[model samples]
Target chain A: MSELDIGILALQGDVAENFMSTMAAMNELGIDGSVSQVKTPDQISAVDGLIIPGGESTMIGQLSMVNGAMNALKEKIGSGMPVLGICAGMILLAKNSKDRVVGSTKQPLLDVLDVEIERNSFGRQKDSFEAEVSLDAMDIPSFQGVFIRAPAVLRTGSGVETLGKFNEKIIAVKQGNILATSFHPELTRDVSLHKQFVKMVADSKS
Target chain B: MIPLSGDLPKSKGIKSESVDSINVTKGTSTLKRGFAHMLKNGVVMDVTTVEQAQIAEEAGAVSVMVLDKLPSDVRKAGGVARTASIRIIQDIMDSVTIPVMAKCRIGHVYEAKVLAEANVDMVDESEVLTPADENHHIWKWDFTTPFVNGARSLAEALRRIEEGAAMIRTKGEPGTGNVAEAVLHIKKVNDELRTIKSIYDSGDKQGLVSIAREFKVSLDLVEETAKIGRMPVVNFAAGGIATPADAAYLMSLGCDGIFVGSGIFKAEDAMERARAVVLATTFWEDADAVKEAQKMINEKQSILGLDVNNLELRMQDRGGSA
Candidate 1:
């Protein structure tokens, strides 16, 4: 059996952090896997799983749209590829999103996740902070949620299962194979989230 | 491709997967340093107006650094280079969805305050701006807003970090339209970091302590930096990067990102040059792709390269005192 290949959407933003964290998670899980940054649809297609790491959503969306990776990403996620979208990635994966300050945006979105997001819901860089989040079902006790100009889930469709919330705001959720977080799990030592996503990919491969 | 999941917008109650409410801790080290991490591997363009800010956003800049004038213009229009007007920074913030950063003259507390109160995503204690105080840099711990400072060498970089800078960029001679200085700065930092990493690997604490004393920083700073084998914060290549190749070369040198000062809007083909630089920075390892990006811009439209040798006032030398 071939080792699972997971691609981090390299359009823009913290691709290296995701690459390192995901690699560590794969190793910790005792799973043979490789992680690479994918900026093109062809690269996206080659990966068994995907992670759209946090960065500027507008930049990521614009690059993804112009490079034709947006549609490719949607196609892959729709096909039930296990995926983890973090922070700005959460904003891109939503069905609809508007900024807390600038109001609505017209940038291209993957729009596969059944949620409406509000950008900078926690405020600007000054308001960015960390939290001790607990993922009840995943047994991720005391997971540090690093929210940096992060979004908040305003609404989740009936199919969406909320995995975590902070200050009454929906911050992490899952709908089948699609997992999204409003905080940066890759920014810290906790690779449990990545490990869980990798396990999902490993299970799907089997 | 369309979304494959249920289009049913039924708002169901959460499945109680959330364990319990969490405590929010603001302005911690992770929050400060992690903010800049999001900008890694991207281009941050400097813009003076809302239009330029929009152009930067459209050109795929990770963020727009709001400046009162391009570094080139700042040089030509010399005098006291102060922080940009609050109104302009607010306007650029309103015009673009990307995070907005602005420069405060090094050691200018009030200017930094105004930029912070204006709610910019980050502040750059910039060398391009005339130093408000040559003897002192801002003690960044006073502000919750993250700050990026320019450094020409590893000691400067570590000093700024010790002073609470969340990110660092090479103090490439701004406005010169020459990347030579930026190249040299990053190379120096890389070489020093390598030295420290090896010194730490050899289990030489005394060497590290002396290194910290030389940097005028804390021993912990040097130890942690040596352990990490890189800048404690995201270090970008900044100032004078006026072309796609310039941006790519800096990225290849291991700078976390690219910051183009007068590189974009000063050119005849600002938008094309901006996009080309973004492409090159994002795919620096791909020589073929970088070549294709270079083809997007005409050399004739490029910013006139300035000979650093002829420049009398080097912006990089400012604010290095104390």
Candidate 2:
């Protein structure tokens, strides 16, 4: 059994927290894995799995492109690398994004997932809040969801599964090896979502 | 690619998470306090426009302070510096997801109210702005929004805290790009803290009382400040910090975080300088990292800094007791 290698996109966002929580999840699961911040294309290619933490999606997308991580991430994910993108990270993973306040945005996006996301669907920064969300499909009885300028999944491809919804709008989705959520799970104490991602990574390896 | 689980999560009783809108007079203090706490070990840059705010967010600034002009520009223009335009503030708010802070003229309560109405994350009762009142500072405790006040000594810091400042920063000479004033201010406050700490350790009640009287603050706040051995709130180093080494040096000096104004955008290589500053701030302890950060931008590209000694008006000398 090889130690699972995890990489976090560190161009910007909650990189450190995600790295810490992923390690914590692995430790709690009695799993041996190494997690490190990945900033370049070569680093991203070496990881068994990747997690893009919540941050400004436009900034992250631009920075990732500048560092050549965008093309690398797209190629790797296309080849079967499991990934978990939170908040702005999820926005980057979407195929399209619409800004409700501005009507449209020209910000850079990855456009991988077959989902159309509405940016700032939750509300502004002051409107950010926390609440319990159900993810019973992953055996998560109730997961604490922290939403800060979070996006909403307006529509998804037939291949995608909606894992959680807030306000009757899809906030979490999975397609193939990709798992994305509009809310930040890393901000909470529960690592059940991360544990599920780790399990998905291990199963992919076998 | 491995196929994801097809089973959808049961949407049985999950209702839309109700959002509690933040109000000015209700539960904002805790929220603002926690927000300041979240900025620990981070950097906050002064940004003038939405594009600059976007750049600051990309450079990993914990938050941005929006102003009408950079401090250096205000100094050069030699005019009354006031809060940024509400339209600019709104554009900045929409540009980034991170917190946005706006400055108010010293002792201007109405300016603070205007900023709160604009929905800024924080208000800086800044001395960089020409003092609107010569005698007193804003009664910050009256507002639910947190305020960051500038101080040059232990007395100034205590006085501001007494008036309900959520955060304290050194009143270094703004716009000069000289780190000396900031250093001196931080040192003065820190030295006084050490004296009070010794007094507390020796169980000298009279000493504590005298110190409180001299600083013109409550004995309880003074004693608690000594017991904590630092400012009761987050203390950031500001004024004229212009380089990676300058930022790293202040972090080494024990400030909680940093506030950079003219240092970044004023530079010829703003983008590289911004990234270098963030890198140096995060890796201040590592000499090699700081060295690399310094090399990111050429020395000639650095701003031509003004000497603090020749300044006609000292921004730090505005408002409040000596």
Candidate 3:
């Protein structure tokens, strides 16, 4: 496999966690690659894959929108650059989203994915939990999921593939090159989900 | 035994995954600690009203800490400052999409319980408010909601952590608008962390134990911190951080993030200062970006700072013994 450059969107939230996990996954998989925190459009464009770590969806989208990286991200993801959006990242990738408590928000979004998201479906930090979620597509039996002010997919378009669910709520989905999850994959010791994304990036480069 | 070659405590100490024990469990140490990770490298602003909360969110704060009044106002009132009104906290919660937080007095477990019931994203057991218990802080592990506590030294920080505080902030002189105390507190923590790391690296088990006793924390916690060379949990600079450069300076000192108490709302240009702090914090390593953010409030400075030495009440001293 050729050397790959993977970027963790660094505008806010868990960028370092994702970078460390992805690098660990690459090392475990024996993939020659590099992972770094990326903030600007050029940094986003240079990577073979990108992971938008879990954070405040409104803040991430608003900041990214103001700085022009949101448009660049849409363009790249539209053209099949492999990307993973976790929690807030999932909120950004969806076409529509509404808070479970507050109803609707005017926050910026990347409307590339055809789905609707329910923000904080499990409730606030007090309601955050650890759950065992099984994603058949990732080829892992079950993974420990950390949900913190997590978002759940309320609707999925025909193109979207349901990857996993917890409590009858959709938590993971993939459509073409875009993959998203409402749980943080970087927070756990398990690297299976990251390995899957790295595999996608490697395949794209090949 | 100190596992010198073992995995760093970054992922250690946190309970390993057990399907039967952890599945669907709220308030697990893992979940509480991971919640703090989400706010790293982001600014959390203190807001009194819905408008200020909205301004904070629009300014790109990762979260807003709802207080009954700004610290400066609380200082002037010269009365017991308690938890914020539930109505105001709920109202702010409704107005913004970001996480909403509020402060409760130290060892005020019932106040914390009320905050948890109110569904505030996080509760701060803060010194800014009058201490409810002079002898002890709340044992935070009992609650499902996470708590952030303030510390002026490594011993204080470790003691709080021992009692289940998931996050730690410097107990700078709140309402003073002075950054001196905050800087001193964080630097003190850093220096002690370095000392512990060097001792552990030297394989001095006796020294480690003595240091642990000195810190009033477990040897295991000290060893874990020594291995990681930083706080076991995310440590942020808080209290009296009035300027964007203050925020940037704290970030450069290796703090995870910042919390602005009276800084934004009491400033000459509250909105612009809020925006600037967020910008400076997010791009702390970029000189050009910090310069641009600093230029926003060109002539308007932050709140005129009160010299911390002149303050009658040293909030940092509250609830220190326990």
> Best by DockQ, which number?
3
Candidate order by DockQ, highest to lowest?
Answer: 3, 1, 2
lDDT per residue, candidate 1, A91-150, as tens digits?
889999999878887878888999999999988887787778778877786797888998
Q: Estimate, for each residue in B149-216, the C-alpha lDDT of model 2 and write its tens digit.
A: 99999889989877767788998989988999999999998899899999999999999999999999
Q: Which is the winner by lDDT between candidate 2 and candidate 3?
A: 3
Residue B45 in candidate 2 has what lDDT?
93
Alpha carbon lDDT at A120, candidate 1: 91
Q: Which TM-score does chain B of candidate 2 obtain?
A: 0.91
Pairs of residues at least 3 apart in sequence or in different chains that clash in candidate 2 = A167-B16
Best by lDDT: 3
Estimate, for each residue in A21-134, the C-alpha lDDT of model 2 and write its tens digit: 899999999989999988779999999999988766765676676568899999999999999999878998989988766656666777789999998786554455556688
Q: Give TM per candidate.
A: 0.93, 0.72, 0.95
Candidate 1, which CAPRI tier?
acceptable
Better of 1 and 3 by lDDT: 3
Candidate 1 clashing pairs, residues 3+ apart or interchain: none
Question: In model 1, where do residues sit more than 4 Å from their true spots?
Answer: B1-22
Candidate 3, CAPRI quality class derived from DockQ: medium
